[model samples]
Target: MTDQKSKDPLHGITLEMILTQLVERYGWGEMGRIIRIRCFNNDASIKSSLQFLRRTPWARNKVEALYLWYKRETAG
Candidate 1:
């Protein structure tokens, strides 16, 4: 068997890592504006945000997309 996840950029990355980086770069207030989830809108913690994101696919997709964009923006 082969690892199929090697082709994915986010394969090895954890949701907590993604949220941490976004929060570090943009902060909770900005993340709320960008994502508008209750987790990001209220007392946003990695545990809370991860729970919400795991249950909500749409919101999770938005977060992943934003993380990718953030990575590109900061790459330069």
Candidate 2:
């Protein structure tokens, strides 16, 4: 038997963790500009963003993509 690691960068990461890191790195203002979603643009909160992202697939995809980009950019 062989142990295989998951290739996905987000495999063990939760949406909350991703959102928290992004907020810490970019803040809500930049995040709004980056993704252009109401949740992040208007009265943004971690709880609200999490709810919105959980319900919206496209939005969630964008967030996940952004997280991956952030990770790659900061890898060094």
Candidate 3:
């Protein structure tokens, strides 16, 4: 067997960690403005955000984009 690993684009990362970082970098209010998604605009929470991201591919994409952007912009 080969000892190879498939990397996650969002590897070694948790959804809550991504969300927390985004919220810190952009703030929940601004995230809503930027993504214009309901999860950010209406009462945002870790559980709710995870639920949306798990089922909504487009929203998940946006969130992942935001994560990369945040990682770059903030030097995190």
Best by TM-score: 2
TM-score of 2: 0.96
Local error of candidate 1 at residue 4 (angstroms): 8.4
Q: Give me the overall lDDT of model 1.
A: 0.91
Q: Model 1, range 1-76, lDDT digits (tens) per residue?
A: 9856587879889988998999999999999998888889888888999998999999999999999999988888
Whichever of 2 and 3 has more TM-score, that candidate is 2
Model 3 bad stretches (over 4 Å) = 1-9
**Candidate 2, 60: how far from true, in Å?**
0.4
Clashes of each: 0, 0, 0
* Residue 35 alpha-carbon offset, candidate 2, angstroms: 0.4
Which stretch of 10 consecutive residues in model 1 shows the poorest summed lDDT?
Answer: 2-11
RMSD of 1: 2.1
- Order the candidates by TM-score, highest first: 2, 1, 3
Index of the highest-lDDT prediction:
2
Cα RMSD, each candidate: 2.1, 0.7, 2.3
What residue pairs clash in candidate 1, if any at all? none
After the best TM-score superposition of candidate 1, give how far the Cα of residue 67 lies from its true spot, in angstroms.
Answer: 0.4
lDDT agreement with native, every candidate = 0.91, 0.97, 0.85
